[model samples]
Target: MTLPAPARFGIMTAPSQVDYADLLRVWREADTVPGIEHAWLFDHLLPIYGDPRGVTYEGWTLLAALAAHTRRLRLGVMVTSNRFRPPAVLAKIAATVDVVSGGRLDFGIGAGSRPDVPMARREYEAHGLPYHDGAHAVSALAEACAVIRRLWTEPEPFDFTGEHIRLAGAFGNPKPVQRPHPPVLVGGRASATLRVAAEHADVWNYPGDDVADAVRRGALLDRHCADLGRDPASITRSLVLPVSYDDPAPVRETIRRATAAGFRHLVLMLPAPYPEGVARWLADEIIGERPV
Candidate 1:
C-alpha cells in the first residue's frame, strides 16, 4: 500500500479553568506551523498534568474559540472519553465544532482512562454515574461510536438500541460538513479498540514511543479491517508523541521514525509552559521533506 502523508498533527492541552489566552496563543502559532495540520485539546474539568491546581481551559470551548481565531489548522479533542457525556450530546458538539471550524474538525474518541488525574473519581461519585473499568469503558466507547454515527447519518429522529445506550427519535441535525460526518479518530492499543476503529473510526491514534510497536499495531488494525471485510487503507494510523525537548533534533527524529514506521499522522504533545515552541520546532524541521 502506498502510504499517504499525514493530514493532521496536534498536541493536547490539559484542561483547566483559566488558560484560554495561552491556549489561543498556542492555536494561533500552530496554525502557521509548517508541518502541523491541526491543534488538539483535552476535554476535562481539571488538569491532567502539572500542579493539580494550575490553570486550564475547557476543550470544546477552546476549540470553538480557536476555530474563530485560526483560519488554517484543524481542531479537536484528543479523544473524548465515553464516560463523560451522552453519545447524542457528544455527536452534536462534534458537529457544532466542525461547523465552527468550517469543516476542519477531527473527532477523536475513546474509553478514557486517567486514573492518576484526580478528577475521574471525583466526578464518578458526585454525579452518581456508573464507574467503568477498562473493559466496560471500551464497551461503552464502541456503543457510543455507533450511537454518534447513527445520530449523524440516520434521517430525522432515528431510533438506536445498543448495549449501553438506547434511544428513540433522537435528533441528529445540520449534519457534519465533512461528507458522511467529520473524521472519527479512535485511540487505543487493545484488540477491542482496533475493532472499534475498523468498524467505525476514520483514524487510529496510539500513544506510545516505540516505532516497531506502532507498526505492529497498524498491522493489527489492518488485519482487523480485513476480518470485517473493510479496506484497511480507509483508516489512518497515527501516533501521539511527547515534545518535551528544547532542541529540535529529538522531536524531528521522533516524527521521522514514526512516519517510517507507517504512521500517517503524528500527534505532537506540546510542552505546557511554552506551547508555541511546538510550532517553531515543526517549522524548523519536517515541513517540506518527503519521508525517507
Candidate 2:
C-alpha cells in the first residue's frame, strides 16, 4: 500500500515529570505549528520509569488548563486509566473539557496496567482502587466504554447494569460538541482490547518501537472487525512511539514504515525536558513535506 495522504501528527508528554512552566511554554509553541493536530498527556499518578515519588500534576486538571491556554490544538490524555475514576464522572469531565476547548478533544482510554514495580502496586492500593490484570481488566474497560458511550449519547436517564459498573437513572448533560461523542481512541494490543476497539473505538492506538508490530496489530484488528461484522475501514489506525530529535533519519524512517503499515495518525512521544525548537523542527521537516 502507498499509505493515506496527509498523515496526522501529535505530541505526547509526561506532565508529572515536566515543570509546569516548561509544559505551558511547549503547549504555546506547539499551538503555532500548522501540522501538529493534537497535544497528549500521559495518565499516570507518578513517574512510571524513574523516581516513582516524583511530582506529577493530575491529567484532567492539566487538560482543563491546556484547554484554556491553547486555541487550535486538540488536547487529551494519551490513554486515561479506566480505573482512575467512575465512567460517569469521566464522561462529565470529558464533556466539560470539550466544551471549554470549543470541541477539540480526543478521548483516549485503556485498561489500566501496572509495571512490575512495588511502588506501582502500592500506588493502586493506596488509592483504594483494584488493580485488575489480564482478561478481567479488559472486560472492565469494555464495560467502562459502554457506560461512557451511553452517558454521552443517551438523552433520557436510564439504568446501566454491568459486571463492573451499575447505575440507576443516570444522565449526562451538556453532551460533548462532537456528535455521538468525542472521538474515542482505545489503546492496547491484547486480543480482548482489540475486540473492544473493533466494537467501540473510532480510533485504535498501539504503542511500540517497531513498524512490524503495528502491521501485525493492524491485521489483528481487521480480523476482529470482521468477526464483529464491522467495516475495518471505519476505524482509524494510530501508532505511538518515541522519537529523538538529534537523529532525524530514524524518526523519518519510522514515519515512513508506519505510513506503509496503514497508520494515519502518528503520535511522537517526546522525552522529558524536551529539547528546545525540536517540535517546530519536526513540524517543518516531516509535516511540511506532506501535501495538505
Instruction: Give model 1 RMSD, 1 decimal.
Output: 2.5
Q: Give me the candidate number with maximum TM-score.
A: 2
TM-score for every candidate vs. truth? 0.89, 0.95
Residue 180 accuracy (lDDT) in model 2:
72
lDDT of each: 0.76, 0.85
Q: For residues 1-292, write the lDDT of model 2, one tens digit per residue.
A: 6635567898888897678888888888889997798889988776667677778888988999988999999889989888789889999999999999999999999987654666556767767877777677889899999999999999999998889899999999999998978999999888889999999999999866578877888899999999999999899898886877767677778887787777888888888787787679768765567542
Model 1 Cα lDDT, one tens digit per residue, 3-101: 466545666555564457777777788777756777787766555555656665657777787888988887788878778888899899888888888
Clashing pairs in 1: 16-56, 16-57, 17-56
Q: State model 2's lDDT.
A: 0.85
Candidate 2 TM-score to native: 0.95
